[model samples]
Target: MNAEREIRGSYWLETAPGGAPAPPPAGDVSVDVAVVGGGIAGLSTAWELARRGREVAVLEADRIAAGVTGHTTAKLTVLHTLVYDHLRRTRGREGARLYADSQSAALRRAAEVVADLGIDCDWEEAVAHTYAEAPEHVEALRAEAEAAREAGLPAEFVTGTELPYPVAGAVRVTGQAQFHPVKYLRALTDDLKRHGGTVYEGTRVTGLTEGEPCVLETDTGVSVQAREVVVATHYPIFDRALLFTRLSPRRELVVAGPIDADRAPRDMYITTEQNTRSVRSAPHADGTRLLVVTGEHFTPGAPGAADVEERFARLTAWAQSRFPGLTPTHRWATQDNDSTDSVPLVGRLHPGSRHTYVATGFGGWGLSGGIMAGRLIADLVEGREPEWAGLYDPRRLASVVREGGTFLKNQAHVAKHFVGDRLPSVTSPAPEDLAPGDGAVLRVDGHQCAVHRDDSGQLHAVSARCTHLGCLVAFNRAERAWECPCHGSRFDPDGRILQGPAVRPLEPREITSH
Candidate 1:
């Protein structure tokens, strides 16, 4: 059970090329641009820069497309859940129109790239829906449809939907597309290489410094000096910019399976209720129609989160309750940072540092957001001012002025956890007391340490303090990893860094046998 618990697959990865030869890691190759991630943003940046005849290199901590892009439902639509109405209320009509234009442009850009490169990704165009499961949300859906149409989107309201269960009403946006995300991203990578770009896998960047050529220090002790840098690794890894305070980390679960052709929804859909129902479909490598469902976000290590195993169980139950015949073939979870305001941060890292740029805080709209960020980052590097740059500038404080209360509350929560987690272990379970395949935070040698007992009954221990910001790391029983409560950095039980904000691994501790 433990072996199968966290071994969930993605439909994109299973259908796309599994094993391919990776480019060799070079010692030190300076380029005109060095993109720090290989997902949509990084690859898109490289692709765009290469088109403009600029020398670019992409440094990936993991394999290309293995980050959030691989885990997405792969919808290429601007039809976000209840966003048009909310934006209209907060950002005004013009701001909302700019957002709609950028998102629509992103959708167009993706379609253009697919046609230009002749990529073999399985693409399909379908209408998108934002439906209400509860009665109270019907009016909100209608408002959303009206606002979306006002903002120049092809949106309308309808009482009937293609979902298995009945919905109160839905806002429909036509001409949206969906495809295999990994396959499309893989083509982008191939196009990058063909346009004189270089890529390095397994390269983890640790620190960044301002210089004539900004220096990015990697975990392998290599220095990447670039005229301009784009920190596109999902969450901006830099802490000095204090971007973490403005961004809140969220985790969402996804479960997909082969369902009958008749059972599949004719269009991609989402719900307006608090715990949204994000649904889409794709064909697996064997031509099996896979239905993907994602929603119910929570902070990774927050007390409110379900026990790691329970999260997956709930996801399975959510699917079985809706589509009873689904035989699940893929399951996984993704972490994204939500910005203070609705808009993502996508300009320079800080006011003082013009060379260092970051694109984060997508708030779960990464498929469209990442592509838009890539283009924006490219424009910034070339000194061409994109129209939407002012809205997404990292230093812009309109969001802070409007949403200060929520930001302060979120920071206060962080401050509480930082102090609360270090005080003492309320539940101290000894190493010998833990069963095989279990873990806990306990007082080890008077120190609060994360201890995991393997199947062999051997204890593995590491400092519970998160390397990113000192928040206590909680044991994620589902993935058998330690996850930071505040910033969403993750580490293996053996103390190796699994994800970041934290490039450094957790400090190893000596565990005396009991």
Candidate 2:
């Protein structure tokens, strides 16, 4: 199938996009807030504003939840990969307590929102488990348990209990949760529309400028006038040049399949292996159980899909050995941003841009991070002081020692993309090779340039080398977008910056005839 058909097939066929698309803004529509990106973060932020009687509008590049949120494992837990001990040691007892409280509160808030909205999102409560295979690592688990206790959370250590594989010991964090992301996002989208909010799908935001009324420009020349902008774009849409050095992206995978109800474990578990393994199960509509296992490599620009497939195969094989008749049915992968520091950035975009706000670097914990960010942004917009505000200021210098080195390293990564660059040779586009709404890299005058033919047969060309870092950008078949493997910078097919670490869009390639 063609690229357009492939994307339209997966997104349109498997499931409808999660959030509701708002009507395009007509003329000069004014709003209290304009939210960029229509995923869970954007919808939730818009929802919070609408509840406060603020006029809100959300603009999406494509359908809502078409990004990472729709494809997540949907694990909602305070147990984020042995964080308690790390937080305690790094940030101190108080910092650890605050982090725990924030995540626990986020879980409760999500449940409250579901109940209040009457959202039928298959929400469920489950025990959150973090285990280790090596006996020596049991000490770390115990430390986490002790930290959790000190933080006023219900937590404990378990040894050799409730798993197919024997573990040295595990940390059990009680009352953690999980649910279907799309289902929840759908309800939020509906509520936002009912509350006089607007959503615009297929309307891509290209740029934003600071002014009395901020201007959000779209690809088609449409503009949104708003008092403030909330960039819940997962990655910052502006100041990409600066934030690029501060954040790096990581990839993860998830697989869902059938498991015997009697044999499936009731709790959610993740291992402490370098290439971690996660196991969790939920009830299927047919009363059988569905197990979702995830794990594998965590590196920037790592070849992940195949690695994830292998890990899933290994996990399923392990599961079947422990419980005969288990099999995997669905598989998906996603990319997420990480900061050198553990906490996410949730405040003003920078010191000078007070009107602009951003939320990024969730570090594979968007469940808690998204809710925390939404609440924090809501508080900021309302001019209320959030207790955790100081903890997550985007501009604050990271306290960790090696952070400076990493920041410098990220800058070096970006530098490599531009220094001493050469173009690749152009190849002829066969009559059948180029299709409407399809894109490919071709050699033009011996330089690599991206070529995209719109439905109208107009070809758009841009430098293939991503501006964020030197990593070659790939044409995302599913999203009809350009994605960078090294740092997760994404651009639209027309050379427009979508998500960033790359502040500048790839300059139009000098298309000289070969």
Candidate 3:
């Protein structure tokens, strides 16, 4: 097998128990709510709605948490990076407070669920810290702590001493939590099903017809007629409302391995570095703790893996350099969407809408945001208005215009890839250039196609063009898949759809065996 294709499987998958993957939905069914995508948001929605006496059905293209939820760092904290100070500056103090309040509420909801279910998922309450390495950034941390305090967050500024490394200053929030995300969500699925909420894995939702009883069309030719529908898929399947145009996709890496538990800091920390390092600890089944580190977020499909790989290699080296005695274990990647503004998009798909809903653009804080979104969506489905709904309204373009420069810049970046990727380029390497388990953009039958050589010296080729918006797809070496830059649609080397706003699989190009 090619070293590039070395699978960095999730620690959660190894530790968490799961049942056999359920078969796809086989026949027509109707329910009060049809939730698409079984990640945290959808599952949370199903759990909440089912408890409220609504018959719910969760349709998942893959297993629950198999998407970004399974790949998360799982720091269930409201302190997302250095966001409080910036949110105050950009969206005002009230906006920052609302964001903090929402996340805190979601955290409380998680605690409530844990207590109700009595599930053990290594749930721990720990302090959250944002430390600054340089002297000048100390004020930034101080400002953030103050801002967080004003926003009803229990935050304070201090000289941190837990870290082995030196730090100028830090903003600290106490009572933040962390847990085994996969284990927690898996247990939640059991609770959901036990309560009469049906779950259907391997059911891909292709389209939704807006009618009195919303008709959800699936790839398997089955239809779900529901009074309300939620598009909780990481990237909402259809962008007929131009949701894709408003989102900026961000890809990040998580690396974890064995660590001396006696030495690791109890607090989960994220530094104020340009490319920040998110540090936390995970408990292994063998009673050892794994030092989990995450950072180096970048846009995927930005030309080559050289930049992403270089960033990843640096994180790996840093891990090795910092903890010389510990051996590194896993290096996996995940991507999430962010609205032009940092706030998540959680509301009705359109204004004055009753049946359709969407929850996406969660940025780096999808863990808690997913919970919050589930609450908001559930409120809407139950005809009860949530107070925080106005805060995360998807139709509100005030932030988009306020951050016009950033919003336009992101759109321009996507435009550049959409137009530039299609133009003829002969420099793309030939099919043979790809090693086993490696992929590349090659000219197959005179049309630019994505070609991958499997470890067994077999070839798999698919059209280089993305099925979503016709943008070119780039091979992600870490994940061993083709990722589209424009709208974050992804495909396997054999052209199977992995993620989408594109329901169609990548068009296959006939490849002769090598």
Candidate 4:
């Protein structure tokens, strides 16, 4: 079976119905605190602030919980794949301990909220594993298990798992979890409203002016004035801190399908091999459970359509071979930012900012990291410092120096795309050469134009240069969107913005038939 044809949209989004749309702010709005980006981080932070009796408003560019959070595999585990050992080496044992403690606390906080709010989000407690199929990597797994145990986790090296395949070694950490992220966040949004918090959908914050009362300018020409602002737009739309330099964007594909409850793995699993494979199961309808498999890490637009389709094909093949009779019903992609130091940056937006805070660089583990960020930002807003705040502070220079190699590497990669993408191409495709349901970057007249042909044979043309930073955008045929190889900004074939970093839509370009 072709993975591309068998795949649909996100399972979570298709299953969970969206709530009534909240209208955008009419004109000027005032709130004690404004949380931007209504994913898990924004809503979680808004709810926390509301519970503390602070008037808050959540501004979402799109629907709440319908962005990255919606597409996530929804693993709420403190055991991020192979992170403890790296942290223990780069940071000291105490720093590693703090990292574990903070993430575990976030899990507890989520549990407490679930219980308190009575959210029926199909929450399930399970162990998590980081396994190595190769014997050569067994020692690395053992070291990770030991490091995790030293960091105050119930972790141990094991050679057995419920997975059908055999593993040379695995680091199993208990007390981890998986849940329906959308349901939980929707309930949290409702509860936030109950506590006098406001939410606005279709409101994209475009500019920020920091002051005693920071002002947020939106695309709708409305302004939001707040004492404190949290920029949780996943990739941090505002890069005043030069966060783009330290953060590397990665996009991963996911394929999920229903499996017999008895056949499903009892716990979550991740392996760094094969790009990166993360597996987990969620409660589904009837007697079946949805088995979610995610892998194929690539920079957005770096891979061609054929490459992406091959990746999906490979992932589907792996899942089917491991678990017989499992067919993927859904396939989607999620993007994340990895910090240079491998730790999430969850503090002040910039070094000079007094009221703005940003949360980003979760690598691929944003479920737990976002929750932790919500709590950490809330504490900082309340003028109370969280004990683990120092570890995730965006202002930390020591870690940046220690991880300079990664920082420079990411910059070098981006520089290559930024500079190399500008040189005129010797063999640019012509718009007429594009077949139906295909796209290509063509030099129309003297400019690079992203041109696509619809299934009906109609041609659509847009400027190839990304609005974010002038990097040339490439066509992603698998998703039918133009994505920036640098920074991951995505746009529709019709020149509309699908994701950002880039608030503005792509410019329409005219292409006359030759």
Q: In terms of lDDT, which candidate is strongest?
A: 4
Query: Which pairs of residues clash in candidate 1, taking residues 3 or more apart in a chain or in different chains?
Result: none
Model 2 CA lDDT for position 357? 87
lDDT (Cα) of model 2: 0.74
Which runs of model 2 end up more than 4 angstroms from their true locations? 1-21, 298-324, 398-402, 416-444, 449-463, 467-471, 474-482, 490-514
Compared with the true structure, model 3 gives a TM-score of 0.96
Q: Best TM-score goes to which candidate?
A: 4
Candidate 3 colliding pairs: none
Candidate 1 local lDDT, 183-286, one digit each (tens):
99988888788889988888888888877798888877788888888889888788778888899888888888877776787589887464666888876545
Error (Å) of candidate 2 at residue 497 is: 8.4
Runs in model 1 deviating more than 4 A are: 1-7, 18-24, 272-274, 285-287
What CA RMSD would candidate 4 show?
Answer: 1.4
- RMSD to the hidden true structure, all candidates: 1.8, 5.1, 1.7, 1.4
Query: In what order do the candidates fall by lDDT, top score first?
Result: 4, 3, 1, 2
lDDT of candidate 2 over 1-514, digit per residue (tens): 5421321111111443433444565555578899997777788888888888889998887677777787677788988888888778777898888888888888989999989988877788899888998988988899989998898889999886688778888888888888878778877888888889888877777788887788988766788889999888787767642665677777665656666677678888888585767788776756677777776535433334324335545655665665667655666566688787777888888877767888888888887788878888888999996777877888777453536676677667655544533434344453246677666777666567777777777777788788755666656543456767667777787788766556567878654321
**lDDT accuracy of residue 467 in candidate 3:** 86
TM-score list, all predictions? 0.96, 0.83, 0.96, 0.98
Misplaced by over 4 Å in model 4 are 1-6, 303-306
Model 1 score (lDDT):
0.84
- Tens-digit lDDT track of model 4 for 1-514: 5445666889888887676899998889999999999998888889999999999999999999888999999999998888999999999899999999999999999999999999999999999999989999999999999999999999999999988899989999998888999999999999999999999999999999999899999999999999999999988888789988888888899999999999999799999998888888998879999999999888888745337778888998999998899988899999898999999999999889889999999998899999999999999998999889999999999999999999999998889988988899999877778987788889878999999998778899999999999998888888889999888899999988888889888999888753
Q: Report model 2's TM-score to 2 decimal places.
A: 0.83
